[model samples]
Target: MATAFYSHPDCLLHEMGPGHPECPERLAAIEDQLIASRIAEAIERESAPLADLADIARVHTRAHIDFIERSAPSEGRAWIDPDTSMNPHTWRAALRAAGAAVAATDAVIDGRYENAFCSVRPPGHHAEPARAMGFCFFNNVAIAARHALEVRGLARVAIVDFDVHHGNGTEAAFAGDERVLMCSFFQHPFYPFSGADNQAPNMVNLPMSARTPGTAVREAIDLVWLPRLEAFKPEMIFISAGFDAHREDDLGNMGLVENDYSWITEQVRRVAERHARGRIVSCLEGGYNLSALGRSVVAHLRALAEI
Candidate 1:
């Protein structure tokens, strides 16, 4: 079976500000590398559909949804937090970003694809049930995981996050839910400053120091995350695939490189093949340096496509 790649042009229309790290060009960079490296021809491409409000409401409150809807600006940017904002096209773009994740989940579950990757963004993971923060508008992975469990009738699912920062919003969404198992590692004392203490039993939160190397990350995954995920025996696996931990990225001080992402994806793939019929859906979370982001995504896709 082929891997599906989900994205939309609408996602490129939303931008926070002039020099913001999370800009539309991030997607363009990935596209450029896909073409330059010939990975574009290897995977199946699909356009992302807009998510229904009901689907979004599974993880976010109706009031929060309404707030985002009403917050769309007519001309300039409307700030949600100091670092997050909405432009005229942001409302539609946010829907497309989340919609990509949900659509990819369905495609993988239905066996249309062995696995999938969503390249859309206003990058989610920080957006909570009642608030949007840290360059996120909706918790896309959380919403899709809920959909798999509640709407699609899956008994178990797992979420893996490897962003430089903690996935506070995703943690909030599935903290106490036994049906979902979340494994994540992020820089300690970092932005959002979460996932360090008081994590639920189902969540394996590993906080590393600023200069932690990829070897330590891989060891942690093998020692900690793999055991929990193996025990969970998830029917599907979801990844909050953030590449900002790369050494070239200025957002964080982690020393991860392209090979690190490929290795991580391979480990996740092995688990998927063992228990979940190779079902995995990965959505883009963060990667600021355009060159590094593009290269890292290519490495991730090569592993996902097994090429």
Candidate 2:
């Protein structure tokens, strides 16, 4: 069984600005590292398709979908927030990003691949049911989880978000939904601060302080996330694989390293193997430092591919 790597050229066309951290180079960095690290040929690469409005609507409101479509600028940038913006290609790029997740989910479920990784841009996990923020326009992982449940009739799924910021949008989409379980850790008192205050039984959101090290994050995952995931016994696993928590990434103040990400992927893979028949769909989220992002993603892929 091989890992499916999903990406598209449209993802490169959607840029916030000239020097924004979440630039198209982020994907290029990943590609460069994949080739440099010899992981490119180990996985199967697939171009992402445009996500259908119905699939996106499984997690986002129709009004929100309409707004995103209407928000595309013809020739200039349109600001969604202070840190987020859109160009003419943003709408299609966002759809492809979400579509990669959905398609990856189906591939994993159908056993076409052992697991998958979606390396698309306009990284999701921040776009709420009706609001877009934090450099995201749609909740990609959330939509994929919904597809696994609503379309595939899976009874349970687990969402693992390791981004530096809280997945407030994903939480908004499935906070009280018992069919889904979301586990995450993020920098506290940071951008889009909300996970620490959440008390949902199905959500295991750990808010670590700014400078928290990887050891602490690992402890929390081992003691908290793994136990809950084991108990829930999800039929499939979805990972919002963000690398901004890397110590070198200036986007946030966390102390995780490439080895930490590899370890985290291994842990997640173990759980997936145990409960989900090794069905995992991981999507790229945040990691601004190009070098660190590239290295971290390669490490993650190595772990997922067991290479």
Candidate 3:
């Protein structure tokens, strides 16, 4: 089956600021690389729909949703946190970003596609149940996981987050829930510094030091994440595909390259094949340096598509 590619033009309109690193150009960069690499034509492309409020409520509080809706500005940007903001287009863009995950889940579950890649933003995995942070408004992966469990009757689902920063929001959503297992690694002593401690049994969070190399990351996955994931035997797998760990990204200090992204994707694909019947849904989270992000995403898609 072909892999599904989900994106929306609204995603490109949710800009943070003039010189923000998490700009709309990120999507264009990926598209350019996809075209240049001749990978765009191989996958099935689809426009993302707006996520339903009912689905959003599954993972976030109604009050949180109401607050974000109320915070949407008519012309200028509204600051939720010092680092996070919402423009006139941000609210709709956020909905589409989360919606892409839900649509991807449906496609994979229905066997319309083997797997899917959602190239939407502002990056999630940082937005908590009641709070938004780290350039995220909604926890897209968390929402998708809940959709698979509650709506699709999936008993077991796994979320794999490889962002350079910890997916604190995702961990918060599924930490105590037995239905989901979240495995991830991040640069410790970094932003939203909370994953190294207070981890629940269902969460496999590995915190690496600054400037850690790809070899160490591979070892952590081999010795830690893989064993736990295999035992979990999830019915579906969701990936928080972040590429900021690339060495060229100024936002993160990890020494990962495109090869690291490809290698890790292969490892995750093996786990999915073994336990989840190759069902996977991946969403964009973080990857700042445009060139590195584009190159890294190509490598990741190559692995996911097995091309």
Candidate 4:
């Protein structure tokens, strides 16, 4: 089955500001690389639908959803946090970004596609149940996981986050939930410093030091993530695909490259094949350096598409 690619034009309309790292151009950069690599033609494309308020409410508080809706600006940008802001189109963009994850989950679970990649943004993984931070308005992966459990009747699911920073919101959402197992590695002493401690039994969070290389990531996956994931035997797998850890990205200090992204994706794919029947849904989270992000996404898609 072909990999489903989920995105929306509104994702390109949610601009943070001038010179912001998490700008709308990031989606275009990935598309440009997809076309250049000849990968776009091989995949199935679909427009992301708006996520229902009930779907958003699964992982976030109703008050939080209402706050985001009410917070939409009429003329200019509204700053939610110091690093995150919203333009006029941000509300719809955030919905589509989250909706892409839900749609991808349905496609993969229903066997319409074996796997899916959500290329929408206002990247999630930073937004918590009641708060939005790090340019994230909603926890996209968390909502997808919940949908798989509640709506699709999935008993087990796994989330793998390889961002340069920790998926604190994801961790928070499934902290005590045994149905979901989350494994990840992130640069410690970085932004939103929290994942190093207070880890639950179901969460395998490894805190890598600054300037850590891809070797450590591979070791963590081999020694830590894979073992736990294999034991979990998840029915579906979710990925918080973040490429900012690439060595060229100035957003964070890490030594990952395109090859590293491909390698990690292959490892995840192997896990999905083993126990999940090759069901995987990956959502874009973070990646700043435009060239590195584009190249890394191509590598990731190549692994997901097995092409």
Off by over 4 Å in 4: none
Q: Candidate 2: what lDDT?
A: 0.95
Superposed Cα deviation of residue 233, candidate 1 (Å):
0.6
RMSD of 2: 0.7
The lDDT of each candidate is 0.95, 0.95, 0.95, 0.94
Q: Write the per-residue lDDT of candidate 2 for residues 1-307, one digit (tens) a residue.
A: 9999999999999998878999999999999999899878899999899999999999889999999899899999999899999999999999999999999999999999999999999899999999999999999999999999999999999999999999999999999999999999999999897988846999999999999999999999999999999999999999999999999999999999999999999999999999999999999999999999999999999999999
TM-score of 1: 0.99
lDDT of 3: 0.95
TM-score of each: 0.99, 0.99, 0.99, 0.99
Number of backbone collisions per candidate, in order? 0, 0, 0, 0
Q: Give one digit per residue, the lDDT tens place, for model 4 in 41-76.
A: 989999999999899999999999999999999979
Greater lDDT among 3 and 4 belongs to 3
TM-score of 2: 0.99
Clashing pairs in 1: none
User: All predictions: root-mean-square deviation over Cα?
Assistant: 0.6, 0.7, 0.6, 0.6
Off by over 4 Å in 3: none
